[model samples]
Target: MRTLLQAVLSAMLLALCITATTQANERYIVKFKEGKESAVKAALDAQGAKLALDLPKHNAAAFSLPAQALTGLSHNPNVEYVEQDAKRYLMSQTVPYGIPLVQADQVSDSVTANIKVCIIDSGYDLAHEDLSGNRVEGANDSGTGNWFTDENHHGTHVAGTIAALSNDVGVVGINPHGNLNLYIVKVFNADGWGYSSGLIAALDVCEAAGAKVINMSLGGSIKSRTEDAAFAAAETAGILSIAAAGNDGNSRYSYPASYRSVVSVAAVDENKQHADFSQYNSQVELSGPGVGVLSSVPMGTALVAATSVANHDYLAIAMEGAPTGIASGVLIDCGSGEQQCDAAGKVCLLQRGNISFADKVLACEQGGGVAAIIYNNTAGQLNGTLGTTVTAIPAVGVTADDGAAMLLDVGNDATVAIGPGNYAYFDGTSMATPHVAGVAALVWSHFPLCTNKQIRAALQQTAEDLDTAGRDNYTGFGLVQAKAAADYLALNGCTAGGGNNTCKGKHCR
Candidate 1:
């Protein structure tokens, strides 16, 4: 009987130790009654509580204390309340790299103008967090669906580049000051393809809606005379039309970008170099940041992935078509993942090459792997695709250096998180067209008296020249500069010959 009694006492002591250890790490806020702040603080200090913060304004203090002590303090007459110290996130806005590249960030955001900019593509996601607060209005010409619903996600991405609200979340657009009005004309279907007749009809909608700037992030090799005439007429009616210069990586002309009246925008990387996929022809009139361009997509539609090892985060790109999920397990090195070995319930760290990314991930999944990480075999980061193959596990890619670092902690715990987000990165001249369109509206808003022709000329004249000296086929007048063009109009007036053309009073637009 005495031995059994001693065993029960030992178990009770162990349980108490475990509970105390867990409670000691918990943080909470203790609010005291009026005139009891000093006394309550003294009592808490006597009990060995770790005070983190003092809030005399709120008559509260933050501390880490034992759960038993917290319960006792809650019953004290001097204590008003006790609450868990929940985490709070900063609702800050991210300025995309292209904003400052074109000098749009240097321009003033206080100026307001109701200059309408029309987007013609696969409709818009009107409910996006970054795009909801703007003065957005729409019209549907493609018959696929509603103008406010984005089926292909292309139009929503384009719209964000033009006027995503200056909200404290997601990303900010070129004209985020809520001055420019957006008019979306859905011409492309969910398949991301449309006929020239539909584009022409969309142009009509833009004209009727009083859109001074039209952005078309789409094009084809074939040119139609009717399409040509429609854009020509739109330009004659004081509308500035902008279009992508194709992504064929050739000198081939793509209409309606090849049309005489349209401003053909070519894609450039963040380094200001022409993208290999960006079409280069005599019609290529301007350049804008397009490669790896990050912008708003349909809410909860974009895939965001991250990988962390040993509590340190590493840049990771989710493999295209990979499943969305989160998994944490012991990191295991599975070379090439051609023939996985013993990766059960672990994250397979594979090296790039030997097979397609899909096959590698499939091999890992077959071996009971929870996740896969494929590191680049070359110098740069590996942005891989899974093609038509599907896998049940999440997979991501990292740079060669990061991969090497991850390999060092092979037996350590690692985590891979893949989920839907509100923004994504896309590459094409399709991405570049909106930057120019947004800048056109931003510059025009300041110079409301400037004619469409004058605004067009000012953009070309003040552009930062690149490639071979003056105008070239690859990048024409080079990268479009927003502040430079705005300053040009401030000094040269609305016309090329110089005239005083400042906007007057509240009737700016």
Candidate 2:
């Protein structure tokens, strides 16, 4: 009898909780009959409903009202069907690094707000602090999973790189002030993987939602006719699609990116050279900062950067194979070993060359070293791959200058610490794609009347020519230049100098 009474009380409590949650707030976008917005507003006013936003172009108004008021709305002679306003959540965070590089700060937020960019990837984490209030209502093409919440951090991170809030606390986006709304189309699952069919569906939805640009950071090696057709249709509808060239670091084609309808973006390092992990091919359209690219990540897991040799701070990239911990010790120079060296319990400092990066780390492990710091023999910070996993210790790469400084430390202890950071660094064409996409939106927002073709041409014409002059496979048309694109649009209008073709000789049709 006691157990039965407790169960009954628990059931009642659950019911109350459910009712409270369901009744909290209800919002809807109500479309009124053509030219009857005033009548709709009057009707809403009679029911004491709150108007959230007025959409004269769509003949619609977003309202917060009770069930009784909603019923009253349907009875109005001028009323059209109402849609329940979808709930959108925040996802990820970002810090400013790529924005100044592209000179996107020259433009204001009000200008960018006119452009709506659709991010077709995993769901967004609506709870992310930096991404608060950046979402707009669009189709959730994730099929079974909820599209508003991002379980996988990839989409959220991409969103941050494109448009993280400009608040001084976190990273500023390319168009940080621009009201460029992000329409998330959850094409991937919780594990950061998706099918081409899902992506195709997302494109259809983005087309209907009036998205100006589509950023696809996910791709597969195989080609699908269904996906290609969908991309072509999106292009026909005047949506600029930008995608990652793939991370294979080869000349092979990666589908969707390889599709002619899309602008296939390749990745470049800080030095404006092709990243070692970035893919290359004739299909490449442009390049953006990919190596050591910093952006937002899921909450709790931080991407910390704190390393010093001989008390002088220097930038370091923590190796993916590195274990989770702080490492500190007297830096011991490990000369090119044709023989085994004594590096027991100390931080082994290895110079680049003499052997592969993996073998050097292996040697450190064999000698019972606590950590391994590999410095570049030439220049720049080393971003080396160990080829395989090592459980012995944490490893990282420092610049040649830091490496030389460590070598000079004959007595002092060289400290290396790895822990949580608000931001993280990632590499690949995936990172570069967002930079181009964000700049595209920034340029598009400035000239909202321009067709997608015009925007694409503006981006291409404005890119800083890299490598060989003109377009090339390695660096595409060169790195994407945001300010130059905007300037071109302002000076040339939509069409270029020749006839009605506003796209600098590129065919619009």
TM-score attained by model 2? 0.73
Backbone atom clashes (below 3 Å) for every candidate: 0, 15
What's the distance in Å from true for residue 137, model 1? 1.2
In model 1, state the lDDT of residue 202. 89
C-alpha RMSD in Å of predicted model 1 compared with the true structure: 11.9
lDDT of each: 0.81, 0.71
Model 1: lDDT of residue 214: 93
| Error of model 1, residue 494, in angstroms | 2.9
Candidate 1, run of 10 with poorest lDDT: 1-10
Cα displacement (angstroms), candidate 1, residue 451, comes to: 1.7
lDDT of 2 by residue, 201-268 (tens): 78888878878899988788999998898898888888899999988888989879899999999887
* Model 1 stretches astray by more than 4 angstroms: 1-89, 377-381, 497-509
* Distance from true location, Cα of 363 in model 1, Å: 2.3
